[model samples]
Target: MLHLQVFTFNPFSENTYLIYNDNQECWIVDPGMINEQECQELFSFIESHQLQPQAIINTHAHIDHILGVDVVAQRYNIPFYLHELEMPVLNNAANTARMFGFEYAGVQTKPGFLSEQHLLRLGNDPVTVLLVPGHSPGSIAFYYEKGDWVISGDALFAGSIGRTDLLLGDHPTLIHSIKTQLLPLPAQTAVHSGHGPSTTIGQELNSNPFLN
Candidate 1:
């Protein structure tokens, strides 16, 4: 069975996920722990669970989603993974922090990138990459088909959808990706998003105003 620990961090309350399978391997997704205590809490959870994280992944490169990429990467000695187009956003996290009137670590950097790897080991359970880039230019969601759940960043939400007002955002593209990539999944498929609550594809299709 795959085990998960979700931490709501930062002012935005970005959801950072730690996933592990029965093998005691784990992966951290969107390490947005904006403060030192949050970071410690995150690491502490991993240690407490005896999880050995094998990979670090970001659903997108928005500042809120990636504020602690550098810290997590450095601490775990793992290569960070993000879509190719988020380089600009990754490079400007500090600027975003400044704009948000928050302090930045000043060491924010993009240390890695992702391609369609056959398997992403989240503690022995393999997750497949699904390119659902609608929230941002390079936004992508990861899916573990075997597990019947997806980590759907901002591209999707419980009842609303991601706003396309930011850089490299496009409404039409997001709609297309959602229709083609997400809705096609089994109706009962679970969607774990970056914020708010989790919902199933069927529930969204039946009730989401934005999706309709």
Candidate 2:
């Protein structure tokens, strides 16, 4: 089994996931930590556990979700990974934050893109990349087949779904992503979301007001 740690960070309360394997090597998923304490906690955890961070993976490039991209990228000398389409969104994080009347620094648009051909594996687990657009043009989800788990970014949520009013978001596409990318997973598979508590694929299929 993979070792997982979650940190709810930033004013947006984005759930950043740290995934590591038995070798003590790991990857950062959508690290949006805003405050010093959050960053310190994350770094402290890595130092204490002796984890070598290999990569920075972004589910999408929303302003709230990519806040810590610079911190980790600069500190670890690792590249940030996102879909090609999210480059513009990431580049405009400052504007997004400004529009919301918030002051956020380190809004950069320089990160690598991840395609279906690219794969991220830790230990024996291989994370299959699924380009799940709709919540955002380049939103993607990572599925660990053997582990029976899916890390759903902002595409799907508990009792709800990601808002489509934002940039490049379409309600129809979001619905399609849910029906196709997420619903096909095994019913018992655990769904780890970008925010809120974790839920099962079966539970969301049956109970999520948006999905139903």
Candidate 3:
């Protein structure tokens, strides 16, 4: 079975995830560690668990979600992946950081692109890439069928949804994306969001104010 671990990091309290399998191989999702101390926290966990990080997979390229991408990717010598449409957002990271009063050296590594056409795999297990969009132009979610869960960037939340006032955000599109792409999942499927606590698809469907 695939195992999941979460770390709440940075001033945004973003949730960074480590998805690993029995083989000790893992994919680091949304590495948000912003400083030396935070970086060490992530490294220490990986070291303690002896996890072999294969790649850094992102749900989106918001500044807070990607602050540690460069550090973790370089340290592990692994490739980073994001949807092709988030390129502009990724490219604007430096400016976004500056606006948010955060120090950023900029992301030096290029990223591999993800799409609905492909599946991301760890060992023999496969993860379906769902193009959910709206929170950002290229927002996506990682659905692990075997694990019965999805890492939903900022698209959907427990009782609310992602704000559409940010760059490239559109409220109508976000609602449509959630209804068409995410809400159809099994009710019991767990939703691991980019921020705050985790919730289930059913919980959100029944109580999420935005959805209603």
Candidate 4:
């Protein structure tokens, strides 16, 4: 079984996930640790558990979601992964933060593109990539087939959906992606969002105002 550890960090309260299997190999998804303390906390856990990082991934490249990508990637010497389309979003993170009067150190590690052809695996587990863009041009979800859960980043929320007011966001496209790509999953499948508590596909399908 894969174990998922969540860390809420930075002003955005973004949820950073560390997923690992029994073999002690793990993948870091969206490291949001902002300061050295936060970064150390993450590293300490990995060291304490003797977890070997396999790769670093992002569901999207929003500033809040990638604050620590640079630090983590460099520290672990791991490859970073994100959808090719999100490069624009990632590239714009620094400017976006400045506009919001926030500081961003930016990601220095070279990132590999995530596509269906490029499989993401941890030990014996296979993680499927779902192209559920709309929150951002290249937003994606990591679906763990064994757990029947998806790490949905700012895409579908508990009682609401992602806001489309930001740059490159489109309401119609967001809705369509949720309906066609996410809602079709098993009702029992858990939805582990980027900013809030977890919910199930059935819960969102039945109650999410945007989807219903």
Question: Best candidate, lDDT-wise?
Answer: 3
Clashes of 3: 0
Predicted candidate 3 versus true structure: per-residue lDDT over 1-212, tens digit per residue:
78999999999999999999999999999999978999999999999999999999999999889999999989999999999999988998888888988668667889999996478889989999999889899999999988899999999988889988878989999999999989999999999999999999999999998888
Worst 10 residues of 1 by lDDT: 115-124
lDDT tens digits, residue span 1-212, model 2: 67779989987889999989888989999998887999998999999999999999989989888888888999998888898988777777778888889877645536777895467777667888988889999899988877788889999887888989987789999999889989989999888898899888999989988877
Query: Per the 3 Å backbone cut-off, how many clashing residue pairs does candidate 4 have?
Result: 0
lDDT of 4 by residue, 1-212 (tens): 78899998998889999999999999999999989999988999998999999999899998889999988888888999999999888988889899879877578888999974355778878888999889999999998878999999999888888878777988999999999889999999999999989999999988888876
Q: Between 2 and 3, whose lDDT is larger?
A: 3
| Higher-lDDT candidate of 1 and 2 | 2
TM-score of each: 0.93, 0.95, 0.98, 0.97
- Pitting candidate 2 against candidate 3, the one with the higher TM-score is 3
The positional error of residue 31 in candidate 1, measured at the CA in angstroms, is 0.4
Query: What shift in Å separates residue 188 of candidate 2 from its native position after superposition?
Result: 0.9
lDDT of each: 0.82, 0.86, 0.92, 0.89
| Global lDDT of model 2 | 0.86
* Candidate 2: segments with Cα more than 4 A from true spot: none
Q: Which residue segments of model 4 deviate by more than 4 Å?
A: none
In model 3, what lDDT does residue 200 have? 96
Report the Cα lDDT for residue 169, model 4: 86
